[model samples]
Target: MDRVLLSIGHGYSARALARLLKPQGWRIIGTTRSAEKAGTLAAEGVEPLIWPGTEIGPALAQATHLLTSVSPDPEGDPVLRQAGTAIAAAAPRLSWAGYLSTTGVYGDHRGGWVDETTPLTPSTERGRRRVAAEEAWAAVPGLPLHVFRLAGIYGPGRSAFDRLRAGTARRIVKEGQVFSRIHVEDIAQVLAAAMARPDPGGVYNLADDDPAPPQDVIACAAELLGVPVPPEIPFETAELSPMAASFYSESKRVRNDRIKEALGVRLLYPDYRAGLAAILAAERAG
Candidate 1:
């Protein structure tokens, strides 16, 4: 049996990946910070284990593949900080290892396009941390580490529809600003494809074909729900949370050609339109 260990699997993208691989005869063991999340993973047919609780002895030795979706904190990459040596020691048994990163590592491109080879010039603290984390993982000796730089991820309960219904959706318009996004399903599919074709120390950008403005996506969701689209708020005057405002600082259209060419990935939802429509359709069916 193919055994994979997902560090920080309770997150949105990792959970989706677990579902995608479970049916393929893969035994998945996911780590979480809490027993609450462990129970959730268990209910979804995944073996959940608490991370940083015990030495990752059995899991690390048994895993053929390992993936870490945990983000870097001020202290640095959490997983690497905790188990870097153990992970390196177990590299002989591990066929592939993956680290989930963000496109923010490219920093503010002033609405230009960026690819995998783009220089890391992050403008935000979070982006800087991600860059540092990516480097740390790459330096792990003998670990077949592949880095996936993900764009804005949205799916199911996390889409604009939920925000609109919750009365928290905003049409914050920053002039000449567009952002690349990826459906969660696409991220899961791409990871699966990468697992099939392991590439050590390869970096791939996971983004959709369409890079749209924030306001336009909100308008589209409103149209789907027959709700009034919120009035456009100028980005300069909009009262955005620190985290939300930080997103506006960067504007880059991320290219996903590598995923397509290398992984042979045909996206299930190529753009926001297709992605949002699928979310709405699923809601209606439920």
Candidate 2:
């Protein structure tokens, strides 16, 4: 049987990917920060390894496939700082390695379309950290390093509909502000497809077909829920957290042609409307 290792596996997308791959007879090994989450992971049929800046042991060196969703903070990534050496030591044995990054690395493209070949010029500290982390992982020898630049990820219980129901949905308008987004399930499928092909040293942009304004997405959600659309607020007048406002500063449409051509996969939710419909359906059924 084939085996896969997932670092920082206790995330929304990682858990979904584990479930998707489990039925295909792949032995899943996952790492978590907490012992309690490790126990939960074990119950979910994943071989849970506790890694919290401590020794990573031989598990880092033995996996056939590796995926990491760890984000870099001011203190930096513990797994990479400590266990990266172990992974680098084991790189020669690995088939494929994937690092999840963000489209924020492209910075504000001014609503222009960006593809895999676009030069990275991240504007924010978080995006800069991600770029740095990408460089760190790319430096590893003998590993098939693949970087996935993900857009706004939404799925299941985590959609705009939930916000609308809670009466907290906002339609903040910034002129020319648009963002590309992708459902979490599509992200999993893309990752799986890339793993199957094992593209070493390749970069792929993951996004949906439509790149719409933020207010449009919220209005669509309200329309789907049969509720009044939230009133749009000017960017200056809108109450937004520092992080949220930072996201609005960028206006880029990420292209998915490379993922389609290379991975041979199609997005389950091509846009927010379709994705919202599915989430609403699931909520109704439950």
Candidate 3:
């Protein structure tokens, strides 16, 4: 059985990946900042390690695979800054290492498509931090690093359906506004495939087939939920939180062809509609 170590494994994407990998006979070791979440992870059949610092444990040093979902903080990523040296010391044991990043690193493409070769021009502090972390991880000698630039990730419980049901959904219209998205399942599959291939120092974009207007996604969600579509408001006139407003300022279409062609992954949910329907069905069944 393959041994896998997840440095920041308590996230949505990491949890999903653990679930999928466990069934395939992989021994999973997951790190969590909280002791409570560590206990919860142990109960889920993963070997939970408390990692509140950047140090790497003996178990992590011996693991064959690693996945990091920790986004860099403005101050710096303690985990990467600290463990990076330790991991580099044990790089020979690592078969593959995956770093999760956001498509925001590509910044605004003016609704144009971008791929792995796109030069990074991150607009936000968070995006800049991620780019820095990517460079840091890639510097680890002998480690096969794979960077996955993920678009907006949606899945069963983390979709627009929840917002629509609560009547908080909004269609904020900004001209030339578009964003790409990928289902969480597809994210897991892509990461798993990348791990299997062990691509040395490669970057790949993870997005769905369509990059549509934000309003379109919201309208579709309302239609699927049998709720009235929320009224559209001009971007300039809409009241948005700082985080929400920041999203509207950028327009980029991320391409996933490299991941598809390299990993031979066929996305189960290619668009928001298919993903939303599956989530709705799962919710109803439960």
Candidate 4:
């Protein structure tokens, strides 16, 4: 079988995965709605297709692997709604499939730890939608699906450094609250490893070992930048949109032991400190 990945709803995470697969001579077909992003993906050596606007059946026909990072809404999963039937038909032909899910599906754990076996009891509608989406994707027979529950993704342009430099980084003090995070590269590598060692129906939580308070991460970013650390703003007092506040509502440490054990993977940036430092060094290098 040819190594071809049909990536639906290709975004930041999928782009990182492509960076790894493209070097290995894998043909990547990533979908995007924007013409500009399509051009960018093409520049990165990925064959981009305008999706939801174009038929994905042709691409699905040729794919040996499938990956989707699309989020569901009040209605349902877009990939399933648009190409679910096509994906179902392509399942038997696919060697591997991956669904990019959020750890939010595990819901709040009161700063406690959660593993892949944890039950899905999301407090918010967003989390509920993820649980629903996961089930929907798994329902496809012979899909050889692997679900990855990702932590807060940080790297390059999307790290705390950008917020600090832009004077928007906040040290929100929510006592007894902490969250796990993973570097984008780490996530990319883990996904690649999973592909190399396909374990269908496997669900892995992708996160660094360290789960620290949100404020500490912000403080470290300021110190690294040699800027004044942003003052602590109590979570309640902090002015935030509903979406931002929702992040504060849930607090849990996500365990990534399965990825290390099952895939024999070691994290590149294990903690926020190392992750932030690399971002800073990359900036100074350029």
Best by lDDT: 4
User: lDDT per residue, candidate 3, 1-286, as tens digits?
Assistant: 5566655655889888888899898888888888888888988898888786535568666688888888888767666666767777767878888889899898888999899898999887778888888888887788888999999989977889888877787899999999999999999999889888878888989999989998999999889888888999999999899988988778999888998899999998998889888888888899
Stretches off by above 4 angstroms in model 4 are none
Model 2 TM-score is: 0.95
lDDT of each: 0.91, 0.86, 0.85, 0.94
Query: What is candidate 4's local distance difference test score?
Result: 0.94
Model 1 agreement with the true structure over 142-237: per-residue lDDT tens digits: 999999999999999999999999999989999999999999999999999999999998899999999999899999999999999999999989
- Where is the poorest 10-residue window by lDDT in model 4? 78-87
Question: TM-scores of the models, in the given order?
Answer: 0.98, 0.95, 0.95, 0.98
Deviating ranges (above 4 Å) for candidate 3? 53-55
Q: lDDT tens string, model 2, 105-127?
A: 88889999999889999999998
Candidate 3 displacement at residue 128 in angstroms: 1.4
Candidate 3 is scored at a TM of 0.95
lDDT for model 3 comes to 0.85
What is the full ranking by lDDT, best candidate first? 4, 1, 2, 3
Deviation from native of the Cα of residue 164 in model 1, angstroms: 0.5
* Cα shift from native, residue 138, model 2 (Å): 0.3
